[model samples]
Target: MPIDGLLLNKLIREAQIFEGEKIRNIYQPVNDEVLLQLQSGFLLFVLKNPSYLIKLESKPNMPDTPQNFSMFLRKKIKNAKIIKIEQLGLDRIGYIELSVIDETFELRNYKLYFELMGRNSNILLIDEENKIMDALKKGVSPKRSIMPGAKYIPFYKREYINILENENLYDLNQPFMGFSKISKNLFYEYIEKYDYISFVSEFLDNLNVYTFEYNGKKEILAFKPVNFKYDEFQNPSEGLLNFFELQSMNSRFLELKKRLEKTVIKEIEKYERLYKKLKNEEKEIREIPDLEKKGRLLQAYLYQFKEKTDFVVVEDWETGEKIKINLNPLKTPNENLQVIFKKVHKLKSKEIHLKERIKITKKMIDYLYQLWQSIDFVEDIETLMEIKEEMIQEKILQDKTKNKRRKRSNSKPYEFEFNGFKIFVGKNNIQNDKITREADREDIWMHAQGIPGAHVIIKTNKKEVPMEVLLFGAKLAAKYSKGRYSSKVSIDYTMKKYVWKPKGSKPGMVLYNNFKTLYVEPI
Candidate 1:
């Protein structure tokens, strides 16, 4: 839910908990978000769509290279202590009064204003005289100038009565300052269900905010949401942070999924082109024998062709058939024979090189396809991060960080319980390697046969594995495979002892013996 003036008012009041806290650090995690690490906790001001400010419980990840606005804020108020935090006239505008030591070794006062109007939201730094120093977004408009050196103009005021001060005279049809449309509607519902006096008393005394599901989506309001189960919080800031952080995580997950899919698809196209070219070169190997035969024919007929000519007729020694050999008229017959021998030698060498290239290219195409299919199985941002980290390690994508060491992910395999057997399915190549390596010798292993797919393992505990459980595992393997949409998929299964990863092979690639195939529909 978008933050209205009332929500911003509640947020500003809750922000007072960190009034005297010193600024420990500052960061711009993305272009639209800024995180303030206070001595007490982390404060974030998101200035993009659905903008709001809250005190986070922990610090979020920071980019290695800071944005220009973040750099400016860090230089100006890295260690500044908050003098005060206030909301302007119950509007969606908030300012933090901070004091920091200037270059002259004296304390200077500055205000950071957070304008939380969607699409027009901005965080600006103001001097004591209220002149704009810099803004998160610099712009020029007819009503206001958000550029440096321009005077800071607060948003146009609307004459709405304060509901707390004039609750008896306030009408639902008239504007109530700071109250959102939802809040206004809730006020009418409350007055109709109960009485105005009790509603006013509760509104003034309420210190907690509630969050609930409405229309299958989460929403937060100052008053208790009607006809829904809700979670209550004494502090509004924490509630807002928890609710929005979850939304942010889901949004970030979807964005990363689309980006990874695009990257993998692009890589697949590139490798497919390379694969086709290499295959075409492989066709040239078929001409090697013909070139050697031509060289031999030229050697035998070297004396018969005395004059410079483009063609010479000869008899094939092996087939006893007449053959015409094309020659380069600029050279002698021996020179032509030498050229044919050179052509034959070059083709032979290229044939060896082409074979290796074709093999590697086809493998790459298969790997990229696997990564593409694996993206659909990703359930969280951490899984996407793991996939992205894998790409960076493989040099398929460049690492955006500046020489920063990435922490290794410990993402576990997806687990399912069926018919008293525990089935573990790998989500990505790394997990595939882990699942197979860690399984017991007698545990059943399964995969989609002749296709890029997840590795499935059933922990047998040295018990006799049932046929039904094996079929269940096979269904899972097919579901996660590239052939997921097929009516039926072939799944190969064997004991863990019979499956072995080949030396110098790619991740998730393995060779197996004593395997049985099962044809089953994807689960």
Candidate 2:
């Protein structure tokens, strides 16, 4: 599940609890990942360098962090004093004030900020110097906004306040008028913002005493009123009323709050560890080009070492062509070396992609969790399929089909009409080939430039194509291609007659002349 608002609230509460604590030690486990130890008596509260993000994380593993950012954190803000901490209203924005001295004899105040990790992680540090020390995000700047050098500006506008702080639980039974109007969205909104569902539930359970129930032969509807009784012991016969009594007597609210806080802390720790591991693994993988060269050198050495008698002549099976094949008794050492090299290369590539996938997957999971917490929607197979397909397109998951082509039907092709023009998109390579061959010369054809993407054709029917229709076709082509969601993609468009598939070009590979390059960003 995505990290809910409750988890964030709990983290904020914990941060508040350790607000004025003195910094004991600070160290970076990986490049950007800084660990801050705050001493509150004997217990230490560790606030991870907020700049480092937990990209991909598993339950039993550490999350991955970006390399350059981690390095930046290690270089700067090492063992800096955390002066003051403040929560940004009810949202997941938390500001940690830090004090650091530069080369000149002067104390500089910096605010280390943390926003929730979503589509982007927006943790940043801004100093009194009015310069950006660093940011978890490299995107966006104060200059982009109207307010420049604003000390306390949030990354995004604050929309709502903490629900608990807004609602008065003390005067629960005042009128009960507002209580009945609370919808599921409001209930979940409160649940997300205040990590204290047990408290809310307990409060409601106690307030059930003033609840009204109506009975009828038809469908029976019930409305509950909020009631709070500070004094006088009531009978424990009422169902929800008794629950409140037990909750009050056992003082489980405090326990639940503690549990929630611990869970948030543990999640933060897990993310921190995963971020460190991923960063290190990525560093290792980035060294593969050098490793590949070394492997090639080793292969050359092994090949020469067994050149005397170990090599043998072999004939090709197709034509009985003679070829020198290494047949060392100890096995073709060079061939074996090449095999190992290939395996290493594959492993390195896989490791990098896997890390990226895991990171994206974690983000998606966190998103789903948050959505689930806010809504009572059941995640079905269709949603999972869409998510899987998205992941595959993102290269987070390997496409199982690879280069395989599906058989196409010989029946009439499916077509869509938009803006008084027929739009035909190929279902597969065979269909694409048929469409290109059979379509009128005047029809406009479009394809993703220099990539194995879909075939899109706009049936212009010997008429001048409208600019809007051309753009529509281009957008659709870009949207379906590998470059979909990218900032800019080049799409090639031309007359259908000018498009031809090369004799042995792979499926979806085609040559086109008199084509126009359309620079477009997909919708």
Candidate 3:
């Protein structure tokens, strides 16, 4: 749910400590967000959809080049002292009044207003006369204008009851201004099960803001909801900031997942198309043998052709069958025979080249499939970053983050323990290569047969592995493979000694022998 006026009330009360502080610095973290640096702390105003205002504990990363409004604010009120802060009648509009000395050494008064209404949110700098000097976003609405030199009009207030004074809590619907629907539902539900008057007394007297988890989502309010798991904070902004951070991280993770998936899918389609083209060429070249047979027949019947003709009928020496051969009427019989032989020789050479190309194309398709399947198992942004780095190294993606230095995380195989045995499964090609090449000579290695998948290793410590453990390893191999959705998948297993990497082969490409196969469903 978006931050409503009631929640803003709690935030403003906690932010009262900053009223006497001076604005030290201002930053525009993003196009829609602004940060106000002060002697005590930072105040962040998010002016995008689902906008909010929160007090930050530490300084956030700032853009190298400041935006127009941020630079304007810096020049106008760099060391302005905050004199007062107020909310407009439980509306989602808060303003901070400041006093600053100008170049003439005369005291000037200004106010910075933060309108936290979703989608229409904006921040404006207004003079003592309440004329807008500049705004983060400028526009003209039907009711008021937000452009420079226009009168600043606040949102119209609606009639609301003073809940603190009124004892009767019934008939509360959408009538109470600034109270969200979720808050009303929560209060009504609480009043049904417990003593309403006593609960209200305790909630109103409580100084801390509360965060609760309901239906797998985090919610913050002035009072904690009963029967829900909650975390308490002395400062209300902390709880709200934590919720916002988690929300932002989740959004970033999903966006990264989409972008990486799109890149991998593009590569997969390219290889698939190439594989199809190679197979088609191979099919055309397979007709080379038929052409060679025709050429030999023409050579034997060269003497039979006396005049230039377009067709000839001859009997096959081996099969005693009559066959028809088309002749080039303008050329001699011997020349026609020579032409057929030359065409056959050229086709024979092409056949060999096509076969080699077909083989290489097939391997590329398999490698791409492996990369595509690995994206589904990524649970966190860090793992996705590893995959992204691998793609960049392979030249599949551009190095967009080359200028930014980031710490490389050590990629590890997924480890599981069952029946006194440890099973390791590789999620990506790099991890697969690491596990297969680094496993002990006697340890067991497993992979799904005839499909792109993760490599699974069972740590035996040179001891004999049990059949149950082998089946466990096979299940993991199938589950992480491209055939994961199949009801039954074939898993091939062998000793690590029997597995060897081919010379100059791609990562995760290996040859194995003396292996056993088992059929099982993915777990």
lDDT of the candidates, in the order given? 0.85, 0.51, 0.83
Model 2: per-residue lDDT, tens digit, 1-523?
1222333443344345445565454434443343455554211112232211221111222246436554554445545666766656545466778776655757767776776544444556677765566664454464453132434355544434344455543333333221222322234444455534554554334312222221311110011222211222222113323333444544444453344334434544665666667677777677677556545555544534554355545444446566453443565556655655776777676785867766754554343322222112112223223333433443444666778863322433347777999987654444456677778988999987865455788988788999888888888777666677698889999998898876644334467899998988875
Model 1, range 108-199, lDDT digits (tens) per residue?
89999998888788999999899999999998999999999999998846587766566564455887777777777876776777777776
Model 2, residue 458: what's the lDDT? 90
lDDT per residue as tens, model 3, 1-523: 7787767767776676799999999989999998999899998898987787888789888889999889999988889999988877666788999999976898999999998989889999999898999999998879898899999887646466545555666886546656677777776777777867866686656556777777787778776676677788877787777777787888888898788889879988888888888787777677777777888888787787878888788898989999898889998778888888888787777777888887887877777777777777877777777777778888888987889986775677899998999899987777889988889999999999999899999999999998988988899999999888999999999999999998867667788999999999999
Ranking by TM-score: 3, 1, 2
**Model 3 regions lying over 4 Å from their true place:** 103-106, 160-168, 190-212, 289-352, 403-406
| Model 1 residue 432 CA deviation in Å | 2.2
TM-score to true structure, per model: 0.76, 0.29, 0.84
Each model's backbone clash number: 0, 12, 0
> How many residue pairs in model 3 have overlapping backbones?
0
Q: Which ten residues in a row have the lowest lDDT in candidate 3?
A: 156-165
Candidate 2 structure, TM-score to reference: 0.29
Report the number of the highest-TM-score candidate.
3
